[model samples]
Target: MSDSRGAAMSDGRTATKGLAFHRLSAPSVLALARGEGGGAAVEELLTAERSRRLLLVRALADSLGEGDPPHPAGTAPMAHRAAWTLLARTQQRAPRVFENILMSPQTGMWLSLALRRLRGATAYEDAPLWVVAGHLSALAAAVGARAGLDFSLTVPVRHGRVPLPTLGCAVFADAAEPWGTAQVDAREGRLRITAGRETVTAGPEWSRSAPGWHAVRRLELEPTGPGKVLLLDELDPYRTFPHPSPPRLLSADEARTWQELLTGAWEILRRDEPQSTEAMRVGLMSLAPTPARERYRPHSVTAGDAFGGVMASRPDDVAQLAATLVHEFQHTKLGGLIHLGPLSEPSAPPGAPEQLFYAPWRDDPRPLGGLLQGIYAFAGVARFWSVHRHAADAAYAPMAHFEFALWRAQVSSTVDLVHRHDRLTALGRRLLGTLRERCEEWMAEPVPPAELALAQEVAADHRARWRAHHLRPPAAAVQDAVEAWRRGDARPPAALAAPPELAPVADTRYLDTAAVLARYRLGAPAADPSDIEGVTAADLLLARGDLSGAREAFVTQLAGKETASDAWAGLGRALAGATEHRDASRLLRHHPERARAVQSALEHATGRGADPVELATWLGLGPGETDLD
Candidate 1:
């Protein structure tokens, strides 16, 4: 290895000179906005993110003096200085290796967390200054090993493991103390770590059989396939966002399943979505496996700090895995673009709070930024399914159609909402406009009429359920409606003209039964009528196209003593599908809160429930029919 002192002599300013002013070309930005960019655009974003990480590391190093007290061993300053020296030498000797480690997702994640703590944005609870600064030494070790430079440094051991950022971790036998320091020595691309008297050596292969070393397993489609390689990260603590999460390594069988699924998904992507495949190869790097979520519904998240990292649960099938990879990479791309510039204003105008808008993908209200993210992500998802449907097997084709149609409508509508938003910057508008153009094109694509209607019904059902759960009618409107009902007036009140306010109800359970039933019906179209979790018989009937049966069942449920919010929404769907009850259907679908309020008032006054359909009809009546107003 080069002498540390000699490497540190290079001027840092010269090395990082123009990184702060990095910009993406207008064409590149437009390409990314439409979610059709090739690898070149993603590479630019990745390069910009790399620059951001470099500047961030420099900033953290410079801020060490202003924050908490120095580590008792002065480890923070020492590691900081060593990291810079190693980075400089690597850049000179092996620029590619240097870029890899610097642009590593964990590197960015650690930099963000460490900087946040240094700036006092978050409290440093159990993590001390030395432990936080130890990541630098970790980075140094990875660079030295990859660059084949002989170097020795002391790195922190959290929970008896030494993480080398992009490479892998050196696991140690259990010890009483949760936190300790280990000495790492790298020579000729081989590595050794020593804690106390125990020492473990790893050769160039980073042999998993080494006494206490766990290599980060790599997943690829084939031994020499064109698919990009991804590290299945289970040992790195900063593999996730916000804080260091304890490693949850997958079992041997679970890991094998992941490999198989990745291979299948990679084949699908390579064959169907070539452009997405190119983007993934450039921007998607590692996968951190999370615990399994609901069946047929995988959960995934990406961090703005961790540009190429994806934290996701095990998927149900190859199709799901492929979709997840595409969905999350979209977030990764958008997150990189956001780092280059602001899309929306940072804050709402002076006094007023930021208005939250409806994000069809989420259970809660989302700010404009969150809504925009949802739009971009699902736009990519919609595009994926739009192509995937034709390529899917006959059994899965219906599901593909449903997903493509559903997300197409959802993303399109949300784009329109955000396009009209007041806080969007000029760039934001352009991005959205491009997105709108793409969605319009998708709208012109032909989907099976049955799938289209089902998709639209599901979208409306979600909106109505969201409205019932999160919006409340004006108090005056509710009171006037109740008064009119008691007076036997045929006309509805004028206060109903006023819009509802956002008053979120805490209990959101069963609000997505329509979506759940849609999935169940599409996934198991011939299954028995057994009760599905979080779904009712009425929900099932409604999802299976039995409108009259569903309406009868929903009416029975509403006539019972305990009725859920889903029943009201389901009844709305049933009426909308039927030939009768047009006005009642509109009232329940569009203003469910109104019917809900009036129903509750009547139930409280009479000590029993009224016919939901009859109540909806009364509430839906036009004004001045009987001069009630």
Candidate 2:
């Protein structure tokens, strides 16, 4: 085995010292093996026995902030000190009891505690942290093992709070490995063995973090039988690379779209630029984890271009995925050139919040203008796909609508690019004009066979517009035309290359619903229930005290959803306040949405004014008993 005796000291701390993962002293190890401290310690720590655990936790947090490893588990090379720094702060907020469990038993009993806490706690801090740590530890341990460092390591302290998990600082050598690796049994979970890699996962059984605003808990590894094992876990080369597989909770269709987009991107890479894929992937892998958040579906991202592996809350169909793949892949390849120098500058655009958005190009010498170019380039790519010929018809309008929305909202940023690259921007305008013209011409004579052709034209124009926007001396006419079009100009010449078919772009019902669900996960305000085309949002309103509007909206939204349990529950709640006993009783009679709601309503009614027998009969509750919280 390759010795990583000093690999864990990347930022100064040694493995055998105060760090989390060092080898235990002979006495402690013996105590652990003899059961004097192992099981009892595990139970005690997992259950939060005393204040000492909190101090150890605070120390662990401090250590993590200092970038110290939990034990001997992590030996992977850290490319930067940021992970260590961030881990330090993250640990300080983590539950100390959970930290002890990992340090003591090195098992995943902390996960059970986390799950219990998650079920009861309302705050992100109250959620378990070890589960998250355990997962990361699995990743690190896996990486270390692949490096030929077969050191026994303790389980991680899991975390995924509003605060996030703490990471340790450890460096591992021997990163390369074989496709099918070896395996080992560890305290936290099974270690999938590979040449230079170790994968420790508890399947979805330990995925206890609450769904928060802008993030979802997706199950990547399938669950096994009752004992908790992950299944069908193939190691992707991408996974081993430093590039993160950002947390993506995709529906089956979105997953398929992602696959297709990657497939198409691969084709593009292989055909047009053989080295592009390797370069792009390598660059991505080398990206610091913090910047990587902006690159994809990051757990802590606030805002940036939705590029790389980042999935948006919007519905991503096959076409949208295809477009995004092409767009982002181009950006990834182009990122090297655009983010580098000559156009770089120190200033952000007037309205833009991030400096990265306004820099001219990666190569710009000035700081401000450089980064702005990168943003423009990516936005341009997304815009191009918005009008692709295949994407023109109403069948995909939601995608177009979203693209257009982003484009329109971002035009102010274009002015910044226009000041820098006028000529390129002008050509883009000319192309956009042609695209709009074609869309108009096609619309005058709509036909199904020409659908793909129209989409292609739209895509070409989309590309042209942004490319022009970035060019020196951007075409003034195109900008004017774009502005005019935004004002509801009917002239297709400003937005399309030809006459276009006047058809609905997409059926947004399912996508909207999915987006709504996504919003719920991310902790964002959902669309007004009444505004949602197909779903009932009325009960949601009544629950929030908007009684008058909720009643009206409910009447419209819940018309056909009377059978929905949630709908019925809302109606029951709403009806309970009505002065008319008959109306209230009638709504309450909707067969026990869940046996419990019926019984609860009966008790609540008895406390209010209704006689117990009458309310019980109305609720269909048996006369013998009642339950209430």
Q: Write the per-residue lDDT of candidate 2 for residues 399-438, one digit (tens) a residue.
A: 4444443332333334444444432333233323433343
- Candidate 2: what lDDT? 0.31
How would you encode candidate 1's per-residue C-alpha lDDT over 86-156 as one tens digit per residue? 77788899989988877878888888888877776775336676688667788888888888988888788
Error of 2 at 198 (Å): 19
TM-score attained by model 2: 0.30
User: How does residue 161 of candidate 1 score in lDDT?
Assistant: 80
Best of the candidates, TM-score: 1
Alpha-carbon runs more than 4 Å astray in model 1: 1-20, 67-77, 123-126, 207-209, 222-224, 506-510, 526-533, 544-563, 576-580, 601-609, 622-629
Best by lDDT: 1
Candidate 1: lDDT over CA atoms? 0.79
Candidate 1 lDDT trough over 10 residues, lowest sum: 2-11
